[model samples]
Target: MFVWLTQFILFRLAFGMALLLSTDLLASKQLALNSQTADFPVVSYCVDPDWLPYEAIRNNQHVGMSFDYMTYIGVLAEINFSLIKTESWSETLDKLKNGECQVASMLNRSPEREKYLLFTRPFFVGANVLVSNVDQPFLQGYENIGEQVLGTVANYRQAEYIKNYYPNIKLKLVDTELAGLKSLASGDIDLFVGSLLSINAQIQKSGFSNLRIAGIAEPQDILGMGVANGDQVLLKKLDTAIAQLPEWVHVDIYKQWNNVRVIDEIDPRYIFGGIGVFICLIIIGIWWQLIIRRYNGKLVAKNSQLQALQNELVEKNRRLEFMSMRDPLTSMFNRHFMQDRVEQEKQVSLRTNVPLCLILIDIDYFKAVNDQHGHVVGDLVLQEIATIVCSTIRDMDVAARWGGEEFIVLCPNSNLDDAIKLANRLKDAVSGFDFNTVGHLTCSFGVAQHYAKESFVEWFDRADKALYTAKDTGRNTIIAAK
Candidate 1:
């Protein structure tokens, strides 16, 4: 009996070992194929760990809309799957570059990203929306939201859009949609802005009775997946998978998220009748005089409050119009706005018979910094140089972005000496500063004092010509038109 038992135990151990070996072999195969398949052959599927209704991990298992979609693809292709989860968007992107993760799910389709990543046919449609508490007054439209603080995710494209176009509207950024909703509930933010479906699912799961899903805004953008560049096979497979999904499936998904509550405007005749009936009912009460006086007082207060808000809105609009002329990156007047100012300056220059000078500044090797350090650091360098230049120039002088990595300054009523001096100061200041990862850098400047009979193009050409001279002479110097 003892000999028989020993033999059975050995057989069981062998079987278990074989099973383990098979599992490891499948996993290894999946990893190998993920790496060898494209330019970025090693695809890492990077996803936010805590984001629910879109992508999330629950009980150590990847799950959500995107997770389900990926899982389906893996099964259909008969490939064993290995999923990687990341807590931050940047880490996901890093993993893809480091050959750790090969694919990013549910990214916005953008022409700019096409340079580095391969995109699949869109699997789903998403719309940006404004979400608010149920207890608050319903949003008839975005305009009705007024100056309420809108919450959005940090480092998100939508945040940048709102920042640029609606500067007067209050914007608050949290790291995640969960945090955005938390801020809204805590009164830190008035409304949370995000993808309608994702935010709706989150709100539903939170079980926050007071919170509500407001009407979705017009979809400003769409979301899609990104694979590492040159993954044509994977891209084609994704396209096929998406095409296979029936139209009803998409409709069902949309139906689940279209939780936006809309209120219909009351008919004018009904409103008038209702108000008259309420007045008559109050008049017939025992304390009729007192009721009427209190009612009128409340109406007056509400009217005055609305009037004040209207005036404030008008003022905010005026400020927005003024700020529209400014660049968000540099806080200087932007190129198009500067053109209008230049025309005005031309009128003034002609009236006073004074010269109008132009200086064109280009940061040397700006693209190199971007390639070496990253776009974020390059943006910081541009901001730093803009600050230095703005500080060096007189208040009357106009500085503006003349396209990428180039700045144009219009010096009205200033001749060659003033332009050259200012240009030299700018060159020195930019060269002296160490730009974080980029380190110390320099800029080239071309200074041109206008000739009385010169056309705008002629004056600009002279400045541009001098700029080339500065570049040719080795950058970090100022060149003035002779």
Candidate 2:
């Protein structure tokens, strides 16, 4: 899946004919298979008409790698993706935001878009590279761009990345990659950086034989399809359809455009950027050909196999994400999740006009146990406490080990009395439980009800003090903030 998407994203950068060819009238291929299927949805979407290799509109038709991939997905799912006419990428984005378009293609995920768009799993990784005239060699180090005028698409995130991070670089903002290349060709801008495929396409059309890739940029882009936030049904259907296509189609479609080469296992975001990794992987996986042939022979069996793989992939990704949010030692929610989830839970209570509570617990004399039983037994005690707390608390309550032997719980829709009761219950449970020949142990707990208009830290501080009171007054007890 990664190979196909990466190939899907960078496939336009194919060497040789792609570099030499100027006009092939690139457009999406329509599929006639399984049109009679009943579950097919007629999805309305808009594409960026000027973004080549990824998407483009030439002679009034939606075309490019993105459109072709979607058309193939439509065939697999028996859906009709009706294209909505739009003038530019900005207009396409506006249509999506305004609900005129139900879907938008080739979207990069970011913090801002989450408010309006639900992004699907990324379809491919984009390795953005600098494009300059061959005569003017440039370095990949971002510092080299300090004194140069860089041409980039206006309102594009890359423009923002450059402006915000490298303010020293003079920006020559253009409306499209073609415009950027044009600006570069005219020497109006020192150089331009864009998707490898996009710059190559523009270079082929510009008749600029001197145009060559200058350098690859950091943080390679991840491209995904987006539906308006809250449109889960459409998003699920689209993801499922896209996942079912034979992986080779991702590579095959690109091969028709240009010859590709792989560089390394590069994410560009974190490591050395590798080109043509997908092609190399595809070459090595010869057995998949039998499955592909069988799929072509029998759609039902192939669909079943693809669906199984899709489920497995989804499950694995979910588990990985879930595992990342926990403390490995105690199998409790980690401090990182505590920080984020507390904010989320606070917002939920505020939105619903309900009370929230926080409880902080510290294992009394935890150091003594570690000193006597050793670190291994101390770890076991923490794990056992986590299990006891999780099982004793309400299902809606969240539990986390803040640090060391101190555990915190976030209780939604609970008031002072309710929180105190639960905290006392937790304290008693800890006091009663046996610790595998390590003898008995007690915990100090502080409980506080959230007050309206109070900051999270303020409320937490109150609870934390009450917990220390538990420690000072006596262990194995709960104290609620007065």
Candidate 3:
């Protein structure tokens, strides 16, 4: 009986999958018919002549995963792809830009490329990795490559990203992934970046025993065929073809190129034995169900009580977590939370080469306010100042009550000038506000931009010294750390 049930389940699954495939094929056929009616011309395509496993040109023929995918897509769309070979990837880009080729066989989409090409849906996705000499330490990611000379393929998206976002790092451009790896092996470049697939393929093909994967890169690769700008009809057809391609076809092509073994069939004897075991388990489950039913009511009541207790504990834990991170008086983030956030922001600043700034603001004459007006009024003054600080700073800035009568604001992506301007605005807001019973109060600010490779303790010390200067020069003024 279990054997029969297993067979019935497999039949149903196969039938559903068949119906889905039939629907996809019918849609693909309609697209083909449309292309036939339109008389879509043969597409002249270009490819990186050296990139392998993903794509390459050899013996005057297109090859690799992109070639296989395009071959299948061309048949489904009733179109043809004619190879327009180039000697290098740079030449391929020129061909696409010059209209020598109507399609780029595979590439990542970028704003610069978008000017000359219309991209189809991504047909291949893979993570990128950092490659370095085997003696190098394992880096966490691209963000940790401080001061290292990084090499990337010229005109590749990774090079573009590093230039645009991480300009502080020295960049060395190579003509190909193989060249980059060779450069690293010879100690000419400190690191190289490329997609995991092509990187592995090149390392293995070139027998580069000295190179190792140092770390994962920032963004994963999203590759698709690029149609030349103004080729809307070809773009639409390619998109449809890619979307309709069967999942198994993609799996098969990937496995073939990656040298992964494919099992064609499962053993019938194992299937029968598995079904017999399942039947035995079902019989035991039915017997167990009868015993469980005898105590079902009692178990249900106990479960309800346990659920109520669990809910209460979860609520209590949430409140505890909130209390731990927040100041009770001002309801602002406490020092502990700010410490963690500052560390995270500093790492981001280092990684992206973006500027970060810190502003240390101290309420002036706070001890006098408490001594003169009592702690209740002092508490209200703190709350009112917190409100002003929140209102004065941009939403991206994080403000925390840094112990009694002091606060800290962490400004990400802000330079020294911008941070000082923000600090002045905050100081003005505090001095102008009426505290009711306390009348008017003022705040002194010390603003400092984070220096590259500076420790958190050193960064904070600079800001603190500037605050002392502000207090000495006269309270309620802003002083920027030099």
Candidate 4:
């Protein structure tokens, strides 16, 4: 019995390791593929006409979270997308089914749809909510959805899930959320079932002041990108692109659509399992005390081995965390890390009445460095500049590579004047540095101070415009945005 228990525990441990290893391998594959150009130059996708906040077509242009997500994917994969416009939400599905378009973004998985559509792994998740007239009592679940008609956009997977799981709920198919909300407000339906964020946006925009959230209903769907039937090539391509993205990429996109921030998740099942294992081991130790003469040395050796394994796992996790937050070439913090720090510092500044400042730095005529001296020398110049900025900044300040030829510095307790001074210091540092073979390099600087009630993006944009002003006037200079 003891031997079997030991084998079972070992098997669980090995299974956990295999899961982590497989995940790492998948991410590595995504990285490998994302760094290269995709087989297709362009891929077209069908767009829903009025699925606001997640996707919509406005004035012939695709807009919202899914559009932003796929745009990033296209940029990384070196592919282009032409969003094929459809007349209605139902039409969007038909376009993909009939192969009128090759891709559809944020498509929920369904067994019926799977027959004609290939789906990538779910890249985002959101819950289905019931929106109803403000007079309606808050609904807790779909099971309570009795004889009253439940309004929903036609062909929505949310509606489909309801049909499959709770067939008794009367469904009223509508072309859009606007119509559904109108119908509900007029006593034509009990509730409208859709994405919580989307329903809220529609209510606010269309003057559905009479409508309110009846309650959040569940079976939160995992959303994925879908391609035409048997389009494994495109499906795999999208999956790889999504896998290659950092967690912050998804966070940024979600932030644009929803006011709420997504919290990092922990697997409670594993957590509880770990606690159970600890308790089991304690009981085993009590048993072992009776057989100390036979088991003391074996237990000690086993515990030592376990301690070593724990240390090794911790070290590996530390290295991975560091690597994820930094730019490999420059050895500087990357935008992901910078964004997180800015958010933290911004909240602190707001709470304490302390000033926060941002500086945007851009390489002046950097393309010339790559064009004339080759990318190797260009990279070296970037590395050298990163080192200078790292050395010049105060220990309390944070710096990060924002993007190609651009960097940012965050000053936690500094005002506009202080930020300008720091920018000038960094500007001087870069200008004075000897590039060995590449010669001297200069950078343009932009400074901006945060203001009450302004968003993080707004603050960043102000500084970015300042950087542009410096570039327009000349290369090596500073500009402060008002």
Cα lDDT computed for each candidate against the true fold: 0.67, 0.71, 0.78, 0.74
| Model 3 lDDT, full chain set | 0.78
Candidate 3 positional error at 381, Å: 46
**Model 2 C-alpha lDDT per residue in residues 1-482, reported as the tens digit of each score:** 23333443354344324422422222112212222433455778888888877888888877777886785565555566777878888888788888889888776755556567776655555556777765555465467776778888876668767777788888888898887877777778877887765665565444454465666664355677888745877777776766555555666666644332222242464332123444544786767556556745785564455445444433433343344456888888888667756765665466458899999999999999999989999999999999999999996688998999999999988988888889888888988988885878899999998887788899999999999998999788888986
Structural similarity to truth (TM-score) of each candidate: 0.41, 0.47, 0.49, 0.46
Candidate number with greatest TM-score: 3
Give the poorly placed runs of model 3, Cα more than 4 Å off.
1-40, 260-482
Window of ten residues with lowest summed lDDT in model 2: 23-32
Q: Give a tens-digit lDDT track for model 3, residues 314-390.
A: 34333443554679899998897688668667755774588999999999999999999999999999999999999
Residue-by-residue lDDT tens digits, candidate 1, 1-482: 23322432353343334333545543443345434323222235777666556777777666666664564344234333456867776666677666576677667644445556776556664555667775566454356668878888875666766666677777888888888888888878888877655665565545344566554443233455677755767766665656454444455444443433222345698778668857877778656656668877986785565445444433433344334456877777777567655655664466357788999999999999999988999888888888888898986687998878999999987989998888888888888888788789999999998776677888889999999999999998899987
Instruction: For candidate 4, write residues 142-204 as lDDT tens digits.
Output: 877678789887788777777888888888888877888889889898778877667666654
The best-first sequence of candidates by TM-score reads: 3, 2, 4, 1
Candidate 3, residue 69: how far the Cα is off, in Å? 0.5
Better of 2 and 3 by lDDT: 3
TM value for model 2: 0.47
- C-alpha root-mean-square deviation, each candidate: 23.0, 16.9, 18.3, 26.5
Better of 1 and 3 by TM-score: 3
lDDT: which candidate is best? 3
For model 3, the run of ten residues with the poorest summed lDDT = 1-10
